[model samples]
Target: MRFIIDVLLTGLAVFLAALVLPDSAVSVAGFGWAIVAGLIISFVNATIGTILRFFTFPLNLLTLGLISFIITVLMVQLTSYFMGSKFDVANFWWAAVFALVVALIQMLLDSLFKSKNRD
Candidate 1:
């Protein structure tokens, strides 16, 4: 139940971020597609992402952990690949921007939920 809710919320963040970006940068077929994109992103981030990051730790150290941003960008591209035409990213930079926006939106949503829980 919790995992499903988190996935849905991540999907909401993805949808919102897509809207915030230019259509040429990031495009989503619909909210339903966004949800599937979210799942793909989450799964990819958790699995392949983790392994890649571990292997890239040396490079990440040199960049002061900023290499993770590249990892995130790649993750977005991988998600797009899984989503096929349902979700599309224009290129590397656009995917980077999209990933950043999605992270920002998800952070905001998480804080909102945290505040509500505290209330």
Candidate 2:
């Protein structure tokens, strides 16, 4: 189904993002682990992430939406903590970098899929 494909594609994007970063910054054990991490990230973003974002809406507006980026970084750290060694981030900065990369790749993947779906 579409949901399954989205998860798989998001996992692929996470794996690609991990490869794009330095090992010291972000690293994944393998594709399987990347899938696991990606699913967790998506779930976390959907649930806890939504609540946090809603609460931070005012701050996000004050900062021109910079707070959303912070929320994303925290989500990355939470994902790393849940994943243990399989998915790791060196520190806050690296997690931010990883989050940015993952966001970019996910955006790209979504665009591609949407375009193809329309075609």
| Residue lDDT tens for model 2, 50-86 | 9999999999999998988888789889999988899
Clashing pairs in 1: none
lDDT per residue, candidate 1, 20-113, as tens digits?
9999889999999999999998888889999999999999999997888899899999988778789999999999999889989999998776
- Give the lDDT of residue 92 in candidate 1: 94
For model 1, what is the alpha-carbon lDDT of residue 87?
Answer: 99
Model 1, residue 100: distance off in Å is 0.7
Distance from true location, Cα of 45 in model 2, Å: 1.3
